[model samples]
Target: MKLKKIGASILAMAMATSMLAGCGEAQTEAPAEAQSTEATETPAAETSAATEEASATTEAKNIEATEITFWHAMNGNLETVLTEITDEFNNSNEYGIKVTLVNQGGYSDLQTKLQASAAADALPDVAQAYNNWLTPYLDKVVHLDDFVANDFDNWDDVVEAYRDECSEFGFVHAVPYNKSTYVLFYNKTMFDELGIEVPKTWADVETAAKTVYDAKGISFIGFDDLAGVVEASLHQNGVDYVDATGALFNNDKGLETFTYLSNLYNNEYARLVGEDGYFSNVLSNQQIASYVGSSAGVSYIKAEGWELGVAPLPGNVNKAANMAGTNIVMFAQDSNKQLAAWEYLKYITSTEAMTKWAVGTGYLPIRQSSYETDEYKAYMAENVCAAACYEQAKDFFFSPTFDASNDIRNTVPGVVEQLVFDKADAQTWLDTLTEQINAQY
Candidate 1:
């Protein structure tokens, strides 16, 4: 899929008008309290005595037949797979609970819907979301502590990176479903032809890029000079983007980070690829031998018939740090609705579901159990290149969690773009941008 770039102008306007506080909590009130909280502890309440008598609904039957509304951002084949999971959940048990699935388009589109729904107090019981978007909605969403304690898996069972981003408010409003990381993708065929081994560090990657450019008439990578991607590279180099007080983009590490990238553009080993056509085209043709991007890009790379290999993003100090994939959250607080949402969340994130989601799309499986499952392991065994992505998960970063002042984030890309196209001074650019971003922090 072609990832759309929000225009610089629009992002600038968004930064101006948008809250620095990340996502704003949906301007909505919680549902009225239940008169009898006891009803929450009992699934028996879903069935009436007369109705039970009429149908002779057994415990097994009720367990096999429950239904709930689920909203997601999947489309095409990805959408079909999610629907299949919902169908399986509805069929596997006697509980009458059925999941009514809704496709809400992409993440940004889903965010807009959630914002509107939250404002109107009509959020779907469960909805898909990213970590940044969830921060602002925390006040309105139902905390899953009580549910997790009383019912299924608890927070400690999840990955530490996910737990760190979500453990606030004493409850997890979201669950890590399709976790992902960033890695460097290189053309294995090109590497062999160049007689160069795969790059393991930023220095090695940069040297290889220059070699490829010198030997062949091709650029080694297509860099869009984007913000989020650059930040991932910076953080991987031991740069703490935010301290207890706020943004830290102007520090020695941050400047050193962009200075390295500026050197790439200065040397002409990397060039900005436009958002439209020819971006993926050049990469697939091996005109660019390496690209640093999300692990989720694996599916597209494979489908295009490119021989691919991956490595933990080349780091100056550590391994790699990247933003993980989005999280799923709930905004409606009706006890019954939250319970139903929890069931769907649990059902969708089971080892089975995680495996299916990962294979169907290039999303990483969030559950440890899923990684051990036969189906997932088989896929992994076949795709040795994909291992780099999973291996780098240890160093991944969640974006909004560290973007408190939102200054570095809003400025870094512009600085990098200028350095790339305008031959801007790295020290001056870094100093000015740092001052602006740190002021907000």
Candidate 2:
């Protein structure tokens, strides 16, 4: 999917304007209380009949379900799979609730619309959101902790890391919907011809790069996005880019990551797709040996002449992959609508639904039980690349959650560009960028 980048300043301005407007309230006077009457003054049979009638009325009201709106950004095959599952939910449920799906283009467009809706108090019943992007609107979203504890039956089956990813400040604000991680996509033909082993660490990657260059006279690897490389590198080295206070990527670990990438780029061993164009073209043409990218991107990879191999990304200090994808959050609305939304959310994440999702799309299933199913195992046997994604799920980590997260993501490419093209010192550029990012806080 094409991820659209939005300016953090614009998002902040919209949120701020909405918050100020949301604070206004109207006051009303209370009516005077009437004198209390004794219950014994009423006839016993009349009271019983009145109580039965009220109970029946309440039951009828409870049974009358509401139609809720769900906003999403899925398209193509992803959209197809979601539509099928949604239809199943609508048809199988006993409740009178019905879900209407709305596609707001891609994730970026969805976020843009969501912000505007917040400003106008016109948000949908449920929407797709990233953890950091949704943090600012926590007040407008329903915390799912109480619902999970009381209603959801599959809470314990969810992966621990994913569960934590959906929570913030001790409350569950969202649930994992479509989740993915990074993996290495290599050309097996090139590896066998050059007698190179699959890379398991940064050192191994460097060695393989040198081997491929010496043998084929082309770039060894191509990065679809430099910012992703930077993020993964820092994570592998146990460095935090952002936290509660501010940017943390100006330190030793960050410098090491930038310097390593800079050396690779400076030496012509690796090329960023921003400069070299698409990885699919480069890999198929044998211009580069391999590239590390999102597991969900596996569908875009096309190898014409050789077998494609997918594996976990090489680690330096530790094994880590940046978790990529959005979560499903319910908007704060009427109780009936909220309950209906929760039912839909829970249904999609169920074992059967997630199994179908994982098999239909390359997205990782949120529930551990989804992996143990025979259907999923059969699917994995056919698609090895997707299996690698499931293997790396245990080590997946999320980016920082803050109001300025989009700003931080936007700033990453500049730092990488300076390091790769301008030949700027890693520490110096990182320090400057860190200060700029911290200023947003």
The whole-model lDDT of each prediction reads 0.56, 0.67
Candidate 1 displacement at residue 405 in angstroms: 6.3
- My TM-score estimates for the predictions, one after another, are 0.78, 0.83
lDDT by residue for model 1 (111-207), tens:
7888787678677777766544543444566555555555555444455556555543344556766555555667877888888877777798788
List candidate 2 stretches off by more than 4 Å: 1-63, 275-278
Please provide the root mean square deviation of candidate 2 (C-alpha atoms, Å). Answer: 16.1
Root-mean-square deviation (CA) per prediction: 12.8, 16.1
lDDT of 1 at 130: 57
lDDT of candidate 2 at residue 185, scale 0 to 100: 78
Off by over 4 Å in 1: 1-67, 153-157, 223-225, 243-245, 277-279, 302-306, 399-415, 435-441
